[model samples]
Target chain A: MNIPADLKYTKKHEWARVEGDLVYVGITEYAQNSLGDIVFVELPSVGDIITSGEAFGVVESVKAASDIYSSLSGIVKEVNNELIDHPERINQNPYDSWMMAIEPSKASELEVLLDASAYEKLCLEEA
Target chain B: MKKTPLYQAHYDMGGKIIDFGGWALPVQYSGVLDEHNHVRNKAGLFDVSHMGEIMVRGTEASLYIQRLITNDISQIKDNQIVYTPMCYCDGGVVDDLLVYKFNDKKYLLVVNAANTEKDYLWMQENLKEEAEIQNISDEFAQIAIQGPKSETILQKLTRCQLEKLSFYSFQNNVNLDGIKALVSRTGYTGEDGFEIYVSPTEALELWRKLLEAGKKEEIVPAGLGARDILRFEAGLPLYGQEISQDISPLEARLGSFVKFDKGEFNGKEALLKQREQGVVRKLVGIEMIHRGIPRYNYRVQFNNKDIGFITTGNHSPALGKDIGLALIAREYAQIGNKIEVIIREKKSEAIIIQLPFLQKKYKK
Candidate 1:
């Protein structure tokens, strides 16, 4: 439910924090809460190229598995290797546990994503 | 979706609800890990009222039940429970159920909730004579208190001598706070536990009473998620996952319950032929040697050739490892054999181990 004013989000519940050329991405609190007790997180490699609106990885819970879609097309600069061993960190603090850092091909792509208030409204509708 | 008798109780306890086979049931009250660990170490209560209960009563009830199920009903004494699979004529499992024998004239069959109607129709179609069958699923509600401390928590309410109830046995007409009920020393979790069957009206009262009595001991209310993980760790076969209409009981490593020496049953001929000819595919345990969680329906391969698929897979909380049960070709189902589970189009290395990923602590 914590939607920071500075962050942008997608319909798939992924959040992006744009900083210069890099965007740190992770799932929102609503996503983690919906998918309870995350046991395993599949992350893309650091140098892997990912396309926008496509599934880059998977997040598995005790009951089912869900796909983690990329918000914008980018080259993964850094992947959070910590999530491989401790995936429950997302449940504790989803915004802080960023999955990967990507250098987006077009920074203007952020404008198409939902802002804090719009994203909050979307989450409310989903609930 | 159908709601159980304890649905309001679950809502009050902050249970996260989900749709499970058309039943609106709680998947967890607390988190899955906490609830699962509590059931392994301490006592955890579960509302299993969604399970179907059928009554077969008549002068020839015992003989009729013996002809339908795979287990030896004649060998079990009164008030004893026998676990067995009811199969079709082709040896494919119709459903796996527990037979609770009260006497020669009456017996109770507990079956999976999703397969209740199908099983009932099948039983009706095959009915010869003498025995009367009725669906009594809505008449009773079941609650399971599982763990090492289960008896300690439940004994505070009922005057029944739980110590006298051996494993796979039950006591009828037990006084549970002035309400007559049946208490069985059996559970799906691989722990010492008791499954109590009571009237639908008494379900909420009993659940609240048990929770209140075990509050000091930190007993939590678990849901279907923990129930699934516990059963998986115990290597118990689930109907849809382990044994289905497409999967035979013999291929599921449940041949011992087929009781071939006793007499003829529904699938006896096909099962006997299978036993004699040898099973082609076998269910085996697989542990991930690579960095991926094998999930249900994931393709399995041996040396790049597709052998089979994973039936049930998950991250085992008890063993702290990723494990799964896969039905693979018999040649690749050996212990220590190397294989790969295809997860999201990627093949991850895995090894075939024993059936149970964790050792069971059931009170035999």
Candidate 2:
């Protein structure tokens, strides 16, 4: 529900914060709330090439396991190793606890992502 | 999806609802870990009305039921509950249920909700004796109060001397919150607990009354998630996961429930043959030595060869370790056998240990 004005969102409930060539990506607050008490987070390794809309990792809670998809095609530059130990941090602050940093193939892909208001509207519609 | 009698109560308590076998049930109320720990330490309440209750009554009901189930029902006295597996002719489990004997002329069978219709049809098809079987699942609602403080909380409502109630026994026509009910000293969680069965109309009232009585004990409302975890930690066999139509009770380490010495049962011949010849696959406990949570249906391997698959696995809140139950080849079922669980296309090291990842704290 907390959609920061600075970040772009995807339909799969992922948020991307663009900082020059690198885009820090994590799941949205809606995704974290849907998945209660995350016990394990499998993140993509650094230097791994990921495709747009493809599953790159998994997020397992007490109830079920869900696939975490990549928002855009990119090479993973940094992985959040801290999440492996404290996956519940995402439930505490999903926007601040970024999962991975990726160097996108093209900066123009950002245009396709939804803005804060559009993303909030999409969440409302889905709910 | 079907809703239980306590559905509104669950929603009012902020339960996270999910579809479980076509039933709209709560997966968690407070949280899975919190609810599970509360049951282990203090007390917790569960809405188990989704379970099916069948009443069989006739002059030959005892004989018919004894012939239908695997456990020795004749040994049980009146008002005693016996856990057993009803199997097909091939020694494969049809379903696991609890038989509550009222007398030779009457009895009650509690079955899994998802398998109720199938079991009813099977029982009808295999009916060789004269008895009346009625599906009374809709008429009743069941709630389980589990933990060390369960008696302390539930005793405040019922006038029956709960201290005199032994395990696996029940007292009918007990006054619970001014309503006539059947209270049993049995539960799925390996803890001192009571399972109260009441009419659907009085279910919500009894649930609210219990919550109020146990407020000082910090008894929280639990859901299917905590129930599943607690049963797993207790090493209780679930029907679809541990024993299914294709899986025999002997393979599930439930041979004790299948009494070969007692006369003939439905799957007695096949089970006798299986006991004579060894079973090929066996269920065993596995603990992750590597860093990964083994999930259901995950392939288990040794030396790169697939030997089995995980039935149930989770990050145990009590043990603080990743544990699972796997049905593997008999050769790999030994204690301390090294294996690997293929978790998300990655093999994680695991070792076969003794079952019941956590020690049971039941009151005998």
Candidate 3:
């Protein structure tokens, strides 16, 4: 599990990369590895309203379909269109295949997200 | 959760373990799609020891078995196996199982691991004559080596001529490098393979031996996840999904094994009446025209009318398409019939297709 120190993480195994007012959302390495061979990924639309801890999209592997939780409440400003046709990118490089870029409505939620070290400890405890 | 003998072996090989029914089994090793293609091209080994095996032995074993299953067991000879469904009087299935005939005095039934207890109780409740029923699942361990290269790989260890074994047949007391076992030329995958059964005590050694022997053929240890997809693609009926306590074999398109002329059996009357009137529902294959995967228990409709639901569905790498098995009204089962598979809250476009997406490659 690669928990990069630069990004903030959630207990649900989602990561947030805060860039000014925008926070890029994608599942963490542990999440993608757990859901191997992702055959399909349903992306949240660009204009969709997303709430923290709520599922805005679905990520599907061969064996199961998992809900992708939003770590920050926001309006989806940009969607990763590449992942719709190539969901395997999430498995190949989860950090690079960011699912969405949200303009945060609740900026304080991003402050509550776990740091990389805390998330790393959480993964170890779960393991 | 129950653990099989190969539970530790799976962990040592980096297999991702999950709870399968009540058993702690590996759901995947490398990945589902990779293992699926490996079984299609090369050979893949599976730990199927969790499956329940029961023995019925007596002078009236054949007669007892005849009244239990829907298939004509009398039509099969010694050392052969017949696949069948045990049904309730209401025509609902008890379980779909494989009946292995050792002789007129003895028989072995391989049943679903989850339904073992229920199946045994059903047999005991329906016992009509003097016979012995034993749940021998714990005493034995089963491993299946499946694919095009399976025979060549297993041939390296066993001196028994693999070429001589016919499909749906088993040879007992076989020597696989000093390990006594029973090798059957039968498998759930729609590919050529052998399912070997051995004593539970000797199973781990045999598992390691076979993997080492099959190293040249690139045999990977597969899990239940791969097994499900292979069988699904092969158009085989699963116990809980395809046939269940609520679903009958007739509706599952397994009427071929239901012999109307084969003497009286458990559900013969109701099944016969069903045959006379024609089955009300049918299991058909459907492929998605919409982007979403038509998953299990998803509602299916025809012209906004709820007809049925998806029993099983997933993204198939072989077909490169999203597909599923749906149990729907008989009137809506026509091939090329445009239908809708309700994926989530939305109804997605799908078309009724033939049962098997691909032809089975069983050795003739």
Candidate 4:
């Protein structure tokens, strides 16, 4: 349950790292843990427009499949190609292995997500 | 949620708990794939205490069971086990279970955990006057030692000569680490293994002892998650998935387990008619040719029409690809038949293949 102080999280277990115009999006450790042994990742194509709290892709685990949601409204700028061959990388290093890079239409939308501490508390309550 | 006698041991070994059929049980320890591979190559022990055990006894025990199940119990010899389905009057399956014949006057039935209580009541109501049925699920614990190295590891702790035991056969009252146990050369996984039945009090000690004794073989404690994946790879039909109260065994492709030639069994007439006419739907194996993985309840399409739905699916740890079992129209179950699985409103191409997706190697 490593919640890096600099990152923001959503109730859906997605994390966003605010980096000026580009924000890195990936699932959190807690999300990957609950999903169990990720096998395949379907990433949104670059240039695809996504809305906050909407499903943009799917993560298939050995036990079940789950939808990955967009944390903020954005246009996908890049999708991680490494996940195509090695989806377990997301399980190994969820925070560092970003699923996609998006250029937000409104970067201020990130403020609606919870901070690291609040997100950690939410995760505890979920458990 | 019900906890088995070995619940604390599972938790202490880093098992991840989940609610399975109203029972609080471990779904995995390390990971599903890792545990699956361990059982395939090395050895793995499973706490199957949640499985139901029932005893049927009396002078008419054999007659009572023959009228209660779809399979012929008369063919079962002493110390032998038969895999079959218990069906409702309407030809739908109640549950699939293993019947072990102890003698002419007594028989043992191992049923699915989720259907234990229901099955017991069903049997009690339908039982004839001469026979009595008892539920003994709580009185015992079952441990399955599965994989290629299982025999050698288990041989070190048991007095019985495991080499003489044939597949689907059992020996009673054998000493396992000074405790009497019933060891059966049968398992759900597609591997050579033994299933041991012991008193609940000896379960934790037996598990610990086996884990320690099996160190060289790298035997691990597997959970339900791994068990599901392994059985799927073997093409074994699960209760709720492949067959259920609303689904008949004929449609589940388990017709071999139903002996129609044996006269006057439960649901015999319905099955006989079904056999002559054939079922409209049948369970089949699907291999994903596209990127998306198919999951349970996903729609199956053929010839631009919805034909069926997926019963179970996952990336097989052994095969390393997306595979699934689905119930489809009998016309679409042919090998190399092309079909589509609907995933999140999009269609993914799939092909019907012969099961099992992986080959099995049961102990002789």
TM-score of chain A, all candidates: 0.96, 0.96, 0.97, 0.96
Give one digit per residue, the lDDT tens place, for model 3 in B1-364.
Answer: 8989998899899999999898889999999989999999999999999999999999888889899999998878898999999999999999999999999899999999999999999999988887989999998899999999999999998778989898999999999998999999999989999999999988999999999999989999999899999999889989889889899889999999888798889899999888889889999999999898988899999989999999999998889999999999998899999999987789899999887887888775
- Please write out the lDDT profile of model 2 over residues B77-171, one tens digit for every residue: 99999999999989999999999999978999999999999989988887788798999999899999999999999999977999888999999
| Candidate 1 residue pairs in clash (backbone atoms < 3 Å) | none
Q: What ranges in model 2 sit over 4 Å off?
A: none
| Model 4: how far residue B165 lies from native, Å | 1.4
> What's the lDDT for all of these models?
0.92, 0.91, 0.92, 0.90
Please give each candidate's TM-score. Answer: 0.98, 0.97, 0.98, 0.97
Native-to-model Cα distance after best TM-score fit, residue A96 in candidate 1, in Å: 1.4
Q: What does candidate 1's lDDT look like per residue over A1-127, in tens digits?
A: 6889888999999999888778999999999988999999989998999998788888999989999998789799999999888899999989999999999987677779999999999999988
Question: How much of the true A–B contact set does each candidate keep?
Answer: 0.93, 0.60, 0.80, 0.93
| Candidate 4 lDDT | 0.90
Off by over 4 Å in 1: none
iRMSD, per candidate, in listed order:
0.8, 0.9, 0.6, 0.7
Q: Write the per-residue lDDT of candidate 4 for residues B1-364, one digit (tens) a residue.
A: 8888899998898999889888778999989889999999999999999999999989999888888888887877899998889988888888889999999898999999989999999999888658889999989899999999998998999768999999999999998888889999999998999999999999999999899889999999999999999998998989988898878999988888888877776778888888899898999999999998888889999967999999999898798889999999998789999999998888899999998888999966
Q: DockQ for each candidate?
A: 0.87, 0.71, 0.84, 0.87
Residue B325 in candidate 2 has what lDDT? 95
Write down the TM-score for model 3.
Answer: 0.98
For candidate 2, give the docking quality class from DockQ: medium
